[model samples]
Target: MAFEIVRQECMKNPEGRSRPCNPEEICEVLENNQGSDAIQGISLDLSQVGDLQLSADVFRKMPNLMFLKFYSVGVKRSCSVKLPSGLESFSNSLSHLKILWNGVKNFGNLREINLAESKQLTALPDFSAAQNLKHVDLCGNIKSLKSENQLKSLAKLIVVGCYGLKEFSFSSDKITYLDLRPTSVEILDFSTGCMEKLQYLVLNCSRLKYLPINDICCMRRLQSLVLYDIGGLIDKSKLHSLFDALLSLKVIHLDGAFKLTDLPNNTKHLSRLRCLCVSNCKSLQSLSELPPSIEKLGAYECSSLRTLQLTSHFEPSSLADKKLLGPTLCYSVSYLRNLQRLTLKGCEQLYELPEFMDSLSSLSSLDLSESNVESLPASIKHLSNLKQNFLAGLKKTSFSARIAAIPRNC
Candidate 1:
């Protein structure tokens, strides 16, 4: 009973046998099974073949066609489909292909092409003879993209939400991961060199204006720089010369930039910075003094932070010791000694914090929730790996003598 050949039941409609076939009755049932070389695979559902127009050798007599899937459920991008301008007659045994049918111009041994959310795809199709393409997941409404040369085995390129991609250029020097998030790309032109082994770059474009920070400071094996919500068209001296030429940056997410305010005093010499996220940076007020190989620090809802100065020659005299060493409570004092996790949640103009917090010996989570910090620093019982201390929106309740100076298994 293995007569299972359901190419949509060969578009059956001998008077509506469970009706579901148009597009010239499924191109005349693939032109009468073009001699069928035992058709290897073909899964078409372009919304029940609504507007297909095949015949560029309609699968050239199915010579062992590998796999071809054209899916569409709830379709309607004007239901237009026109395949074949380089399935190039199944270039010697077609490999695998999913279709939105823009007539891919030959990518024979295809290795990957997601075509994410096609959204009436705008253009792409000249992958210079693909040569075993590596990875390309493009997002909706792509406006522009130029490649045509130097894709020597692409490594990874994800273009998300292409708004109308303002401008982008690539040549691929073995790209190591480039995510253009929320794109309306305002000219990114990676200075040709093609991101020399780039190691992860997510540009959350807020209409990014331009970027060529000396060819992204010659890459130097970039290690993760997500400019989430990048606004103000990048400035702050080119993000402090791209954090002093990306000294092998470990991770830096400037969440919702909002015109910064301060950060580059050589950001305490990024000695392989571990992680720093300036969450919702509502015009950051001060920070400069961090890189003690940070472990994880998130300044949530910044709201014009005050002056977080941990060290760099600690000098706090007054103004309430600089609002208890502002910037929502600085770090550094003996260099975060490997900070574990410290999130200043909604820093409501942070009131105070630094009584040197016992030099954070590998701090283990401390989030001052909705902060306006009233008090808490008798070195907080010398943290011995404090485990999660998130004071719920404190404005005052004068924490019973700092909760009896913490440490009762904190």
Candidate 2:
């Protein structure tokens, strides 16, 4: 009978449109069919409703209810729906919930909850009884979240754009993926025995001045680590410590870190690292020997960079030495054997390429646009796999005809 009432209300609207339900109308339907065992689903659009006050046992009588979604669309004002305190339990069969309420006590069967963009939500309900909960996505002005020793089964968590969030910590050892991008979180506490199974972490907080390096080093299975715009938070020594611990990492992306002057001098320990990208780091001056496992290397708009050492054999003590003519090339040995794509665009101070450029036999695409490179090494003609070469703004170079004459039949 409850489903019949909801169906009749929907039939009054246009084919593909829904009429927003007010507080009184919604209360009437639920009250009239309070004990009905037929209500299995409910989706209400409360865009036109104002402040709604409901009893605590409103959903207690619906034993078979499995899904409940109460959302507002195109409403500019705060959508307030007050659920009374001591709301003991949702339906025992309920599995999915997407609402803006804070009174539910026992979510024994619930699997996922999405409260994204709930601007008025400042606190989370106790989830001690929610043993089956697995995924949670939270966003808005939430200030503090401490999921200590809870959510034993949680596997994924995302908390993006929470500008007012200041403190956060989760002790879910089963979690495999976590993202906290673009937040104002200042205190992130990751104590022992937390996030041990995590495989991916993306942190883009600008105000985060310190990272718990000891706790992060515990994530031995982490594969991808992306740190964006976290200015001056990680110095060279701390980064070196991180590299030593996170040896299983495959991809490392560092961008907009204005205080970084150099990467770790010896990355050969990261044997599995495949891609290394450092861009827009204006203060970075040099790149030392990288792991031979790197397939793609990109350093763009690093305005202060003056040297690139591709192998351990080529070492220069200082950038001021005029004798350091070009990229230190190894004539007898081939390094970076698996390298496929190399981009050094917008590095205006970089003046030369390795004279033994042919050693990079797997090189396919090369971009040196808007740089100060004087000439392309003649050895480049021997690269049989070279396909795309971009030298757009090299006005000071004398290799235009030489570059065009290279064979393209890769």
Candidate 3:
């Protein structure tokens, strides 16, 4: 019986392919390369072979190829079948081309292009003439892009989830880093002040509703801004119109802005604003003034934040060791005298807590886990540096303290 079917396909497939490698054995590996007239680099991952065609010259016997990767993984619709185009004759020693999750869609002489998880790439071609392109990382569903004079020596443009891109007018002034996600862009111009070495911006668009930031030509060398989950489409009077020249914004991450109540009552002068991360912003309530150079203030899970304007003339060494306040049902913090890690974990409608809390004095660590905050503020016995999980939420909640002033290794 054909010698037991060739010994069960030669000892159960000794790591050998069953068939799919016949493009004349890919031109006998660029003419065995020793003579070296061609063949620089080439990777052809058939993605486990499917119907197999790939012929447009199969890279024309590799005319001094530079680096080419042709792979195939999955998810490709829209009439499909569009690979093997001849790659414009390797467009001058093709630089570096990476196409993942699917077949070749020609991109010769690239500098750096990574397309990961591509459901079905839509655009990107016409690199003007490939003037030493820079870098472009795409997540999937490209939609189309070929302008900005074909990416004028692009720097780094990352586009994620481009749902057939509604718009994108590039202006790469040697672009720094501009990340755009979930694009169906309603409006995005950055006010036309032009990409002046843009300092890191992640516009996690929730159908972006314009981003002019009170135009006078904005984005003044932005320091770091991540508008994560921008659902309410930017309110707060357009985020106070980006506080004048955007004073090199330090780190402002507005997470899940569901309809912010405030922030930008002129941040009192952002002397390099340190770090203000507002998480789960469930319609923020109050926090009207802040910025003695704000040294780390994370408002996490903000269920309608109640207080924390933090002032005592600000600047208490800028919150010293940092990590100040973030689970607000805010009972008040006597002007946060240099806080050092306060979490109020899960503030379950935080009951009553501000018995001056040992006057903070550089609080060591207090989390009040799953808070309904029963009690424990006999000034926390003068908290000398409160550690032991800050009496571990005074053990089993409702602890009003005075178990002999909590000691004996509590």
Candidate 4:
């Protein structure tokens, strides 16, 4: 009766033009009652459904309904569901199922399934028929599986935040992107041959002392790699080797790695690399050089850095040397004709301006705040197109005031 009403209303109103009576007006009482033997191939999950019992007739009526899901609806006690033996009639058709927050047990499936986060539940039935299952998430449960072979059919798996999981086993050929963060996992055995196609890898805050270099080297197509805040990753030998192995890498971000003192040895060889960010490394003293293909360089909050080298791939003669030219360290920064903006904040060692400062024909704005600079370069007066100039909180103000007082075109 319920299915007929639902189907008729759904089909009659092609564009949903008719309105049915509101659910508030409908009755909640279960009309039919039957014994448990009538139910077949039935699966159902419900949460906080207080004092609810499945009469055998209602169970048998849903012989074809194989999948069910239920969550908490404010019930004080768990709902105890009884499985009728009639399920054997439709066992082959009942493949996938889930029972969350419902006291369900002795359920069987032939293919895919999940039973996660039902604290009050215990006991798991053997699922030998579940051969076609590809993904499974059974987190937050303490019940131990009878054997690890149950997971052999799964390809992609998620067991995060599962406290009681001491150990398990499965095939790795079809699985990729396994997340073991914030766990007690000491070592991951990825010697399985299926890791070749893995691309994006993330190991943030894993507390790992080291990683499997061979496994990472096998992923030839790896594009993005992130390894931040790992405790024992002080030496760059392994990291350099890993970087050397990834010939197709495009982006590498390693932030807050306090123990990293030296840069990767062959880092400049990432020929196709575009973006590199190494911020908040307290021990880094200076940058030797960078790849010319790099488009963005984020080296913020790196206190130990003293020298910076900027180069281009066009030609050596095409580059200009502005080192120690004067009290301020400004040089062919204008040659970075492609440079859209420039900032020199807290550059304490700088004292003089580079001769190229006056010829920055492309610079729209300049910032020289919180520096030891005493005066603006006389060449600045020559930049007739100057729009915005930032020289706040300098060591001396008289020099800036005199420059501001000077007449333009002087």
lDDT-sorted candidate list, best first: 2, 1, 3, 4
Give lDDT tens digits, candidate 4, residues 65-106. 333433345566765544342122222222233332234233
Of candidates 3 and 1, the better by TM-score: 1
Candidate 3 wrongly placed segments (more than 4 Å): 1-22, 27-40, 43-52, 55-66, 69-239, 243-263, 266-307, 310-410
Candidate-wise lDDT, in order: 0.69, 0.70, 0.57, 0.47
> What's each prediction's TM-score?
0.32, 0.71, 0.29, 0.48
Residue pairs in clash, model 1: 307-326, 307-327, 308-326, 308-327, 332-335
The 10 consecutive residues of candidate 1 with the worst lDDT sum are 12-21
Which candidate has the highest TM-score of all? 2
Q: Give the number of the best model, judged by lDDT.
A: 2
Q: Which regions of candidate 1 are displaced past 4 Å?
A: 1-24, 28-40, 43-66, 69-125, 128-177, 180-200, 203-213, 217-224, 227-240, 244-251, 254-264, 268-275, 278-353, 356-375, 378-401, 404-410
> What's the lDDT of the predicted structure labeled candidate 1?
0.69
Q: Compute the lDDT of residue 17 as modeled in candidate 2.
A: 17
- Writing each residue's lDDT as its tens digit, candidate 1 over 243-351 gives 8888888998887777788787777778898998888888888776787679988899897887676555545545895674564334345447788888888878877
Runs of candidate 4 exceeding 4 Å displacement: 1-184, 312-410
Using alpha carbons, what is the TM-score of model 3?
0.29
